[model samples]
Target: MKKNLKRIAIVAMVALVIAACKKNQESAETAPQETVKNADKVLQYIKDLGFPASSIVDNGNEFVVEEDILFPKDMQIPAGGAGTKIEQYYTGSIVSATKKLNIRIFVDPSMTSMSSEINSAIAQWNGVPNSTLRFSIVTTAPYDILIKNEALAAPPGFVTCGQAQFPSGGSAGALVRINKTAIASNSFAQRARTICHEFGHCISFRHTNWAAQGESTATNVPGVTGTDALSLMNGGQCNSGATVLSQKDKDATAALY
Candidate 1:
C-alpha cells in the first residue's frame, strides 16, 4: 500500500510540473493578433512576398523580416514587386507616394530619451539635396510614422538593433522599432546611424551590399547601379558604418525622387 501511494504521488507531481510548463508556454506564445483575421493569411502573405516561412518571427505587434523590415498584421499586402541586382531597391511596391514630400515621424515616449540621435537621422534625410523628401519630428498625432522602442529576441551577443516597415501604396510605412537598450553603449554617431539605416528601409532602399551579405536578390536604382562602399543604406553595419549618406546615396535619392 505504501509503495502504491508513493508511485501515485510521484506521478501526480510530474503531471503538475508538466501542466505548469505548458501554461507558461501558452502565455509566452499568445501575442495580440489585432486584425489578422485568419492566422493562415499571414503565413500566405509571407510566402506570396517570396520570403521563406522560416524567416518569419511571431513578434507581438508585427512580423519582422530580414531582422530589420517590419510588416504589421493590419497592413495591406502589396500586390506586386520590384525586380533586379537582387540586392538594391524594392521597385514600386515599397516606395512612398512620389508626391508626398514630407514624412512626419512621431517618437514614442519610450524612445524620446534618444532625441538627439533621432534628430541627427532626420537631418541627414532632410539634407539630401534636390530631393523633396523631408522628415520632421512631431510630438502630437496626425503623424505619418511612429518610432518606438522594442526588445527583440536574439542569440547572446547578437542584437537585432532596429526594424522598419516598407511603404505600401504611396505612404511611408507607419513604424520603426529601435532596440534602444541594445545599442546604448554605442557612440552617439553610431546610434544615429542605426536610426539612419532603418529610415532608409522606410523609403524602400535595400542593403547596398546585399549580394555580399547573401540576400537572395535586390534591384539597383536606375542610372545608379552597383555597389557603394560608402552607402548609408547598407545593412549589418549597425553601430559601426557610414554615419552620413554617401554621394551616390544622395544621387540615388535624387534620381528616384
Candidate 2:
C-alpha cells in the first residue's frame, strides 16, 4: 500500500511539471506571433503614409524607406495612419509644441567625434526665426533623443550617410544613426547638413522632394506650400544637399512649431 501511494504521488508531481512546461512553451510561441502582428501593423502604417512598396526596405527590426527614414517595428503608430498633402511636406504627425520647445539629445560615445557637427545641426534648428523649437545636448540619462554612429549598410550605387526615426507619442523620434565612416570625407558644412537632415526627420519633417523621390504624397505645412529647390530636407542629395535651411524651410518650421 505504501509503495503504491509513493508511485501515485510521483506521477502527480510529474503531471504538474509537464503542465507548467506546456504553458511556458505556449507563451513562448504566442510572443513571437504578437511581435509579427505588430510588425505587420507598422508595415501597413508605412504604406498608408504613401511610401511605395518598392521604396520600403524591411531591415528586420525597422523599415528603411527612401534610404534615410526609419520606421521602427515597435514604434507607436499614429491614430488612424494616413497621408495628407505636399510642398515642404510633413509627416502629419509632429512633435507637440510644448515638447518641441526643448528636445534634449544625448550623443553616444561612438558619435563623440562629431559633437561639433551635432551642435552645428542643433544651431540651425534653434536659429529658425520666430520658432520655439530647440535642441540641447545632455550627457546623462533621461533624454528625448539619442544620436549615435553606426556602420550603416549601403545599397548598390548609393551610400547611406545617416538614418533617423520619426516623431511619435507627442515627442521627437528617439534615434538617429549616422554612418560616420561613410560621410567622413564630406566637408564640415555637408557633414552638418547630414546631421541636420536626420534631425529634421526626428521632428516630423519629410523629404521636401517627396514627390520626386516617388513618395505618394506628404502633408504640407500651412502657408508653406510649393516645392523648395534650396530646401535642406530634400532626400537623395545626401552630402551634396543644402547646408542651411532655406527661407521656405524656416517658414515651415515656424508654421508647425
Candidate 3:
C-alpha cells in the first residue's frame, strides 16, 4: 500500500509540473501584441523599405520581415521610408557601430553552459585586423547583447538554426537567440560557427549571398563588390557555413568599422 501511494504521488507531481508549463506557454501566446497606429500602413511602410510582401510574416505583435528583422507592430513609422530606429539604415549596408569599441555580450543563464562556443565566436570578431570592434562577455547590468538558448523542435516542420535581433539606437541589438539543443551535437567548430553567424547579424551584416537568395537587391560594400564563395556571413548555410571570415569578409569589416 505504501509503494502504491508513493507511485501515485509521483504521477501527481509530474502532472502538476506539466500543468504549470502549459499555463506559462499559454500566457506567452496570449500576451498583447505591439501597439501599432495602423497595421496596414505599417505594413506598407515595410514594403517601401524594399522587403517583398512574401518575406513579411504578420506575427501578431510584430512582423518578421525577411528571415531576421523583427518589425514591431507599435513602432512609429518614419516620415521618410528610412527610419532612425532601424538597426540598419539601408538594406545590404553594414550596420553602424556602437559609440564604444568594447561591445558587451551577456550570456543568459540558459546559455552560460556553452562558454567555450561563446568565447570562440567572440575571439573571431575581436581578432579582426585593423578593426576597433570588439566583443566581451559581461555578468552585470547594462549589457549590449544578450545571447540566450532557445528550445526549437524539428521534424515535420523546419525551423531556423537561430535568430538575431539587429542593433538599434546606435547600439548592438539587445538579443541573440541560439538554438542550443538543436546544434548542441555539432562539432565544436560548427557550433561556434552557428554563433559567429548570428553575431554577424547583430552588427548589421546582410547575407553576402542575399542576391542569390532572391532578395530583390543587396548593396555591395563600397570597395568590395561581388560574391564571396567563402564569406562567413552567408545565411541559410548554418552549421555548413564558412567557419571563419573570408578575405572579403575581413575587407568588408575593415571597410565598415
Candidate 4:
C-alpha cells in the first residue's frame, strides 16, 4: 500500500508541474501585447532610415516584438501571430561592397573590459563572407550617452536594449551602440552571440519564418535545427557559441552579398 501511495504521489507531483508550466505559458500569452506593437513601429522607422525591411529579425518569443511583425504592413502582433498570418519585412538587396560597413561598438564603463571578447566575436563574424562590416569598440556609460546625446534618443517604439544605424552610399555602415542594461542582462557568451546576431541584422537577415519564402510546409528554424543547433542567428538560451551557424545562416549570408 505504501508503494502504491508513493507512486500516486509521484504522478500527482508530475501533474502539478505540468499544470504550473501550462499556467506560465498561458500567462505569457496573456500579457499586454502593446509592447510588441510598439516595437514594430520602431522597426519600420529604422527601415525608413534606408535599411532593407528584412534586416530586423525577430527572436522567436513574445518578449521580442520582432517575432510578431506583419510583413508588407510592417506591424507587430501577438506571439505565434495568434493564428494570424505571420508578418515579415523584405527588401531584396545584396549589401556587399568594399568598405561597405562601418560598425561602432559602445560599451558602458563597466563593460569596457569586454572589448577583447567583443573583438574576438566580431572577428568570427567577419570571417563569414558577405559580412563586409567593421567595428570599433568605444568605452563610455551607455545610458548617459543616450540620455545626454540628443542625437541618440531612445529607440523608436519599444526596443529597450540597443540600437543600430545603417547609412547609405558606398559608405554603407552599421553601428551597434549598446546600453548597460543589455550588458548586465547578458552573459559573456550571450554578449558574443548578441553582437553576431545584431550584425546579422546589420547585414539584412530576417527571422526564420517558413512563410517568408512561400514554403507551404514549416521547416525547423535555421539555427535551431536538430542537434546541430549552432548559429549565432538562433534565438533562446540554447544557440550560443562557435558551432551555432546552421546551413541556412550560411546560405542567408551568401544570399545577402
Across 120-156, the per-residue lDDT of candidate 4 in tens digits comes to 6667655656545554454543311111111222345
Task: Give the clashing residue pairs of candidate 4, or none.
Answer: 70-87, 71-87, 71-88, 230-243, 230-244, 230-245, 231-244, 231-245
Candidate 1 lDDT over 91-120, as tens digits, reads 345455443487889999999999999999
Each model's lDDT: 0.78, 0.89, 0.72, 0.42
Clashing residue pair totals per candidate (backbone < 3 A): 5, 2, 2, 8
Where model 4 places Cα greater than 4 Å from the true spot, the runs are 1-90, 94-96, 101-111, 129-160, 166-173, 209-230, 235-243
Which pairs of residues collide in candidate 3?
35-74, 167-173
Clashing pairs in 2: 85-218, 85-219
Predicted structure with the largest lDDT when compared to the true one = 2
Model 3 stretches with alpha carbons more than 4 Å out: 1-34, 38-45, 73-100, 152-157
TM-score-sorted candidate list, best first: 2, 1, 3, 4
Q: Residue 250's C-alpha lDDT in candidate 3?
A: 81
Clash-forming residue pairs, model 1: 86-217, 86-218, 87-217, 87-218, 97-170
Higher-TM-score candidate among 1 and 2? Answer: 2
Model 3 vs. true fold: TM: 0.74
- lDDT string, candidate 3, 1-257, tens digits: 99999999999999998898787775754333334445666688767656789898887766766565555565545445444322211233233455438788889999988899999999998888978888899899788888899864333555567777555445665578888877878899888988988888777676788777776455666677788879888877767889998888887777668
